[model samples]
Target: MNERFNKLRQYNTSGLGCWVSLIIFALIVGKIGLGGVVSGFLILIALFFLVPVIGFWGFQWWLKQKITQAQCPVCEYEFTGLKNTEFNCPSCGESLRVEGDRFTRMTPPGTIDVDAVEVSVQRIEEEN
Candidate 1:
């Protein structure tokens, strides 16, 4: 899951760069004009802005879905609001690191306990 997230992030970043370049190109074209095709030029300008707005919104929505589905490894807490790399456990007050689908606790060097920490897999619901 981490690998998949990384891939998606990379793709989004590349796409944003492409969109920026296209915006620049559109500006240049608009300034120069295309043999007096004013309507077509206006349409191109609208698309130049529209495409990036849609892409950004879609990317944010997808990220929100992934964050909501994340489960804490220590307290089994499902994250509900904003997504971030680090979050303090609401139930146990432990600091946890979120990486894709995996959650890890940040513990002191000598306080590690193998048996006390309970690790459980979250069950997925099946549709009938």
Candidate 2:
């Protein structure tokens, strides 16, 4: 569960936070003198950047809490993150079916039919 949350958070930084922080830094340095820059500008920059982090963390926490967890359908083996449409099941090497939150077995053991099994990758949604 922690692993899932961490992975979600790691991939959620979309570079917008850094751009906002940079803008805040530049505005503070240009408008206010050095004495006030650290106090005023840094606070703005930190606050802006912190928003994304907090949002990302909260979203990841929700996915881990609510989403259904499943394993390789064909083989009954547990796995995560299948990037390709066709992948050998980690345990049985048989093609698997991944649809939405559940993985259903499409083929039985000792079967190697490419046309039999279908693997679908679902898009992970971030909770608002």
Candidate 3:
């Protein structure tokens, strides 16, 4: 019946808490009267706490823009990686390059296959 919490979400929108804090602050000031010790202290708190909260929110937004989820084309493995970079898929060990939202299969450099294993007599004795 309540429209306030109809949406199923883990958290509210960004900066909602700060806005609520400011509103509660105004309510407290209204009740206690203006130009008093309590109002001055509340204003000081809003300056120190609210400003940094807003700044950190902006930093978080910037970080989201620079990093994103990348899916491996060969194995369809999803992972978090920086935008426009190459990394091996943890699931399949396949080299993949991420460009924007696109995942491209890339060939790893300087990888050589061994035809045989050569072991010395001392090495074989140590293994046994």
C-alpha positional error of residue 77 in candidate 1 after TM-score superposition, expressed in Å: 1.6
lDDT digits (tens) for residues 1-128 of candidate 3: 66666655457679998999999879877877767756688899889989999999999998898787867776687888777787788999887777877777775578654457787766435553
lDDT string for model 1 (9-111, tens) is: 7643657888998898788678876655577788899999999999999999897766745566766877643445677877777788766556778777888
RMSD of 1: 24.4
Residue 19 alpha-carbon offset, candidate 2, angstroms: 27
Q: List the candidates' TM-scores in order.
A: 0.43, 0.36, 0.45
Indicate whether candidate 1 or candidate 3 has the larger TM-score. 3
**Model 2 C-alpha lDDT per residue in residues 1-128, reported as the tens digit of each score:** 68888877775559989999999888878887677976876899999999999999999987675554468754567775433244556787765555676665566679674647678999999999
RMSD of each: 24.4, 25.5, 18.8
Candidate 1 accuracy as lDDT: 0.74
* Residue 94, model 3: Cα distance from true site in angstroms: 1.6
Q: Model 2 off-target regions past 4 Å?
A: 1-39, 48-52, 55-68, 82-86, 105-128
Which model scores highest in lDDT? 3
Per-candidate clashes come to: 0, 0, 0
The lDDT of model 3 is 0.78
| TM-score (C-alpha) between model 2 and the true structure | 0.36
